[model samples]
Target: MTRAIALHQVSKAYGRAPRAVDNLSLSIAPGEFVVLLGPSGCGKSTVLRMIAGLEEVTEGELLLDGEPANHMPPSERGMAMVFQNFALYPSMTNRANIGFPLKLENPRQDHSERVESTARMLGIESVLDRYPAQLSGGERQRVAMGRAISRRPSAFLMDEPLSNLDAKLRNHLRAEIAQLTAELGVTTVYVTHDQAEAMSLGHRVAVMRGGVLQQVSAPREVYALPENVFVAAFIGTPRINLLRAVVHAPLDGRMSIDLGRQRLPLPEPLSAEHQLLRIQQGRDLIVGLRSEAVRIAPPSHARPGEVALSGVVEHVEYQGHEALVHLNTGSQPAVVPELESARPQQAARRRRRAGGGGTGVGVLERLRERATGHVGGPVVSLDEPVSGRQDPHSPDRPGLMAGDLVVRTGPDMRLRRGGQVPLLVDLEHLYVFDQQGRRICPLPRDVPGLDV
Candidate 1:
C-alpha cells in the first residue's frame, strides 16, 4: 500500500543561521514521487534526512500517514532510506544483504525463500553468493536497495543514491529504480542536486535554496513558472539570463523591460505575484532572459523593442544540442543577469536616500563595500561581467546596456572567441525582480497548460 509523507513548518539550524531545511512545509500523496533539488549545500539532503529521522529537526513536525513522526526514532517511522554512498557489508553475500532487514524484523522466516524471491525480483540471483567486495558499484547499490525494500517500508527516502555511480551506470539504475518503485507503488521523497535527475525521476520536484523551500510543483511547472528569482535561476540550464531593466506603462499589458540602450517587450504578461522592487528608466532592475530567448537576428530585420549588442566571443562551451557563449562585456564580470542587476538600483535608491550622486560605477563600488564589509577596496576594478564584447552600440534604446549580456546560440553557429557577433535579446523572455531578489513578473511560459 502507498503511504504519504508530510513536513509542517520544519526547520533546522547550526548556530545563528539555519544550516539546512528551513520552515519547509510539503505534502507528498500516496504513491507519489517527489525530488528535492538544488545546488549542492542548498539543503536538499537536509530535508530528506529530516523526513527519514536521520537529522534532528530544530523546529516543526514530520508526519507519516498523518501521524506525527518527528519525535519517533528512525526504526519506528516505518520508512526506508537510501544514501549516495552504497553502505553494504563486505562479509555478507548479496543474498544475505537483501534479506538482512527481513531477518532482523522477522527472524522466523525461512532465509532461502526470502532471499531467493528478492534476488529474482532484482535480477541479482546470480550475484547472491558474491560478497560486496566482489560486486561492482551498481551491484552494491542494488543490494542496499534490496535490503531496504525487503521489509516493505511504508515509504522510501533517497538521498542522491545514484550519485556515487558513473553517468552510464546512473542512467541505467535510474530506470531500474523507477521501475522498481512503480512496481512497489511506494511513496518516495528523493533529494538531488542535479536537475536532469530530478526532472526525470520525480512526479514533482521541490526546489530549495539556503534551507528554504522555493517552489514545489511538477518538474515542468517548476521550470516554466518559478515563483521567484531564486527558483528561476536555480532550476534551468544555460541558467536563465538576468539583465538590468526598468518597468514601463501599459500597466495591464505585457511587462516592458528597458535594457540600458534598448527596450524589449515580454511575450507573457506580468501577474501581481511579480513583486516589483524598483521601477525607474535609468535606475536598475533585474531582467531575466533565458538563453533560448536570445537569437542571432540580422541587424536590419530586428524588431522594435528588441535589444542588439555586439561582442567578440570570449569562449564557447559546446553541449551536443547547443553551445553556451561566454561573452566578455569588459564591464562587469560574468554577473548573472538576474542576481546582480538589482544591486545597482538598490544602491542608487540608497544613495538617493543619503543625498549622493555619481556614476553607476561609484554606486556599484559602494554597494560592494557595504556587501563585503571592507571600506576602501577598488570596487570598480572588478573584472568585466563578460569577456569579448569590445564594441556595444550606444543608441538611446530603452533596455540596452553596455555591461554583461549572455547570448545563447545554436551549436552549429560556429563563432570563434575573437570573432565579433551581433546578438539579439528576446525581451519577451525577460524576468524582472524586486530589491529582495524576488521575481517582479511572471516567468515566460516555456510550456503550455500552465496558468501563468
Candidate 2:
C-alpha cells in the first residue's frame, strides 16, 4: 500500500476562536489501521469527520490517494464510517441496511449479492432477516460495520463504534475488529478514548490532547515510549505513575532522581539530543513510572538502586490475581515501603509484654539510622513481632502516622487493615523525566540499571 491519506496544516474551528484541530499535519499509509485516541471533546471525532467530509475544513487541505479531497462531499470521499450510535433504520432489515449504501450509489449493481457477501464476512449472515430493533447490541454493531464494508470504500472510518456493547462483548469485538480490518486490507482510521481499544486494535495510534497531536506511533511504542507527559499518563491501564522529582546526577547510562524527600535512580537516560533538560539538577521535574515498572514486595535485603517505602495498609482492592493496596503515607509515598512497615509494626507489637513495653525507640533508631544512610531518610519497616503486643514510643504503636508507601500485591500476600507493610521497589525499573516531562532514562528491558 502507498500513502492513502495526508492532512496539511489542517485547521478546524467552530467560531472565531482557537482551532479545534490546530494546524494538524499527518500522513496515513495505505492499508494501515490508525486510531485517533483522546478524551471526549479533544477533537478526535472532529479529525475523523473532516476526513470523511462530514465537517468542512477551515484552513487546510485533505488528500485521499494523492488527490485533494477537500471539496468532495461525504458520499464522494470513498470512505465508510460507523458511528457510536449505530444509525440503522429500525424499520429496515439487516440486509437492507447493509445494502442501502450500495443501492443509493449504484443503480445497476445487484444489492442482495453484495449485502449477503458482506454479512457473511462480519458473521452476521443469520441476522440478515432481522430488523435493527430485533438484534442484540453486538449484532446491530456488526450490521453497521457490514454496511460500511459492503461499499468497499478505499478507507474505513469508525468513531467509537462499539461503545454501547457490554464489557465481554466489547472485548470480543475489539479482537474481531482488528482481525476484520487486517483481512479487508483497507486503510482505516478509528477514533476512540478507550486506551484498551487503541492498544488492541490499532496498527498505530495518534494521541491527541486539547486538539494537539501528542504522539503518533505503533501501539506498543506509544505505550512504552510516550512522546510527552500527556501520552505517558493517558495511554495505560491504571495509568503511569507521575511523581514530582529532581535530577541528582547521571550514572552510567541511567539518571538518579530525588523523589522530593527521597532519592532513587531511573534505569534509562535522556536522548542525547535532549540531554540538556537533565541539567536542571535538583530542580523540580516530573518522573513517570508505569504500574508494571514497580513491583510490591515484603521488606528484604535489596541491592543498590533498590528503594523501599513503608506505610500502613489503608485499603485493599482485590482484582483476582492481584490486589491494589492504598498505603497511608504522609507524602505521595512510594509503594514498597508500605509493605515493609506492615511486618515490623506487627512484630514490634508482639515483642512488647506488659507496661506497653515502654520506649521501643531501639527499633525506631535502627530504622532512622538506616534512612539516613539511604538517599531518603530511613524508611519505616513493616512486620510486627510474631507475638501480639504493643510497644510504646515506637512510631508503629498507636495513632498510626501517615507515611509514604503504597503497593499492589498478589492475593496470597498476607496483610491486614491498620497493619504495616514494607514496600520493596524494583528501582531497576524506575523511570525519570525532565522538567518538560519528557523521559530522561531508558526502561529496564532496553537497558539494565545497577544489576537490580
Candidate 3:
C-alpha cells in the first residue's frame, strides 16, 4: 500500500532559534521515490524524521493521504525508517533481527515464514541464521532493510542508509534499495548527501539548504536547469563552474556577456526569455556552466547557439571516460557560501554537543559568528545580493593565476599543463543567478512543488 505525502508551510525549530526547516512545502505522489538531498546538517534528516513521526512538527501541517498525520506515532503511521547507523540488536540473529518488530507488534502470530520470505527477497538467506555481529556491513544492512519491509509499511523512509559503507558496497546497496522500493511500490523518501545516489535512484530529487527546499524536480531537470547557485553547485560532479560576469546589452544588434578576460557574443536576436539580459546590462551577475557545457574547440567548431572562450589549462584529472580540465578563464568564482559553511557548522555542532547543550543564540548571531568567527560582527553577502559584489576579503593576487574553474572533457585528448585551450560554451545550457543565489537566466517558469 502507498500513500501521498504533503508538507504545508512546515517548519522545525529547536527552541526559538528561527527554523531549521523554514516554511518548507512539498507534495509527493503515491509510490513516488523522492530523495531529500543536501550537505550534512541541512535538515534533510529532520524532514524525514518528521514524516516518520519521530520528530514533532513545530509549525504547519503534515498530511498523509490527505489526512492530518502530524500527531500519529511512528508505528501507527505505517512508515518504516531505515536509520543511518545499522540499528540491529547486538544479541539478535539475522532472522530474529528481521522478525523482531513483527514479533513485538503481535506476539501470538508466528513471524518465521514472513522473515524467511524477506531474507530471500534481500538475497540474505545465506546469512539469516548468523548473528548481526557475525555479518558484514552489507549483510547487516540487508537484515535492517528486511526488518523494515517485514511489516510491509505503506512508506519507506531511509536516512543516509549507505553512508557508513565502503564505495563498492554503497553502490551495490544503492541499486538494491532502488530495485526493492520499486518492486514494493511503496512511497519512498530517501535522504542522502551523495548527489550521485540521488540522481540515479530517485524519481524526483529535492535539494535542501539551511532548512529550506531549494529545488525539487526530476534528476535531469535538476541537473540541466538548477533553480539556484546552491543547487547548481551541489548537484554536479567537479561542481558547476560559477563565475562573476557583466551582462553586456545589445550592441550592433547582438548581446554579449563579459567574463573579465573573455567575452561571449550572444546569437543575433536573443530569444524573448534571454532578452531579460538587456535589463541586467552592466549589472554584476553569476554565470553557471556544467563541465559538459564547455568543450575543447575553436569558434569554427562552435555550434549554433554557442560561444567561444579561451582558457589556460592549469591541471587535468583523467577519469576513465573523461578528464576534468581545470582552466584559468579569468572569471572570479561565485562560490556557494552555504556549501562552504556546512562543514564548519557540522564540526561546531559536534564539538558543542560534546561540551554540553544549552539554549542557542539568535539566527543573526549564529550567522554572524559563523561568517566572521565573532559575535555581533557585521554580516557579509549572506543577507543581501552577492550579484556584482566583489569579494571584500579577496586574498592578495599573486603574479600568476591558476585555474579557478574545472571543465569536463574527453580523456583521450592530450592536453599539457600550462597549455592554452579554446573552449566552446553552449549558450543555451548556461545558467544565470542573481546575487541572492536565485536562478534568473533561462527565465524558468514555476516548477511544480518547487518552493520559491
Candidate 4:
C-alpha cells in the first residue's frame, strides 16, 4: 500500500542557530516521485530525515497518510532509506546483509526465497554470496537496493544515493532506480544537489535555498517559468544570461531596456508583458535570456517580437552538438552570492530586520504579491546604495571586460575570438525581474486582477 506524506509549516532549529528547515510545507501524493533539490546545508536532508522520523520536527506538523506522525519511530514508518554510502555490513556477505532486515523483522520465518528474488530483480544475484569489499561499487549499491526492496515499504527516502559513483555508473543506476520505483509504484522522496538528476528523475521538483522552499513544479515548468532570479540562475545548462538593465518607458516613446552600450527596443505594438514595464520606468531591473532565446543573426533577419543586439566574442566552447559563445556585451552581470550553498543565519537576520514575522499568507499568495509588485518584497538591486564600494565585474568572471552574456549556437559556426557579431533576441522569450529578484514579466497564470 502506497502512502501520502505532507508537511505543514514544518521547521527545525538547533539551539541558537538559524532554522535548518524553515516553515516548509509540501504534500506528496501516493506513488508519486518528488525530489528535494538544493545545495549542501540547505536542509533538504533534514527534511528527508524528518519525514523518515529520524529527526524531530521543532515546529508544525508531519502527517503520514493524513494522520499526525511527528513522534512515530523510524521503524514504524514503513519507509525504506537508501543512503549515499551504501551502508553495508563489511563483515557479512551480500546475502546476509540483504536478509538481515528480514531476520530482525521476523526471526522465525525463512527469507531466503524473498532475498533471492530481490537480488535477481536488481541483477545482483551473482554477487549475493560475496562480501561487500569483494564487489564493485555498482554491485554494492545494487545489493543495498536489494535490501531496501525486500522490505516492500510504503515509501522510499533516498539521500543522494548515486553521489559516490562515477558519472557513467550514476547515469546507469539513475535509470534503473527510476524503472524500479515505477514498477513498485511506491511514494518516493529523493534528495539531490545535482540539478540534472532532479530534472530527470522527479515527477515534481521542489527547489530549496537557505532552508526556504523557492519553487515547486514539474520539471518543464520549472525550466520554462522560473519564479525568481535564483531559480532562473540555478536550473539551466550554461546558465541564463542575467544583465543589469534600466527600463525606460517614456510616454511619447518606445519602451526599452538599456544595457551599457545597447538598447533593446520593445516592438511598436507593446505586448501585454511589455506593457507592464511602464510601472518600472527609470528603475533598475535584471533581464534574463536563456541561451536559446538569442540567435546569431542580423537585424534584417529579425523575426516578429525579435530585437537586435551586438556583442564581441570572447570565448567559444565547442561541445559535440552545439557551442557556447561567451561574448562581451558591455552589460553588467548581477551577482547572486552563494548560489550553491546556504546562508541561513544571514537570511534569518534579514528576515527579522525586514519584519518578516509570519504574515499568515500561504506560499502562493506571497509569490503573487512579490511578482505583481502590489506588496513589498526583498530588494536585491545593483542600484541600491550600500556602505562599501563594490567591484563592477562579476567575481565568477574576471579579466573578461564585461564578457557577461553567453549564447548557444550550432557547432558548425566557426567564429573567431574578438569578432563582432550581430544577434537577434526573441522578445517573446524575454524575462524581467524586479529589484526584489521576483519575476515580473510573463506574469504567473494564476495571478488575477492585474491590468495588462
**Per-residue lDDT over 1-452 for candidate 3, one digit per residue giving the tens place of the 0 to 100 score:** 89899999998999956467888999999999999999887799999999999899999999999999989888889989898899999888888899999988999999899999998999999988889889899999888999999999999999999999999999999999989998999999999999999999999999987788888999988987788787888988888888888888856656888877778788877787678878888987888888888889988988888888888777889889888999887677765655665775677667665554543544544555565432112111333332443322234533335566788878899997766788899988788887667788877665455442
TM-score of each: 0.77, 0.77, 0.87, 0.87
Give, for candidate 2, the lowest lDDT window spanning 10 residues.
375-384
Question: How far off is residue 369 in model 3, in Å?
Answer: 5.4
Model 2 alpha-carbon drift over 4 Å, by segment: 1-3, 249-256, 265-278, 298-305, 332-406, 443-452
- Poorly placed runs, candidate 4 (over 4 Å): 340-402, 446-452
CA RMSD of all predictions: 8.0, 13.4, 6.2, 7.9
RMSD from true fold, candidate 1: 8.0
Worst 10-residue lDDT window for candidate 4 reads 372-381
Native-vs-model 2 lDDT? Answer: 0.72
- Locate the minimum summed-lDDT window of 10 residues in model 1: 373-382
**lDDT by residue for model 4 (1-40), tens:** 9999999999999997668899999999999999999878
What Cα-based lDDT does every candidate model obtain? 0.70, 0.72, 0.83, 0.86
Give model 2's TM-score versus the native structure. 0.77
Tens digits of per-residue lDDT for model 2 on 1-452? 32399999898998964568887888899999999998776688999999999999998899988899998898767789999999999989989999998888887878888888898888999989989999999999999999988988889999999889999999999999999988889999999989999988888899877677768877877877776666777787665666666666654455656654445644344445235546767676666666565555654665554566555676777889887666653334222232133676456446653334446765665555455333222122222223433332257565544423335568877778777665556654555555555565543233223122
Tell me, by lDDT, which candidate is best: 4
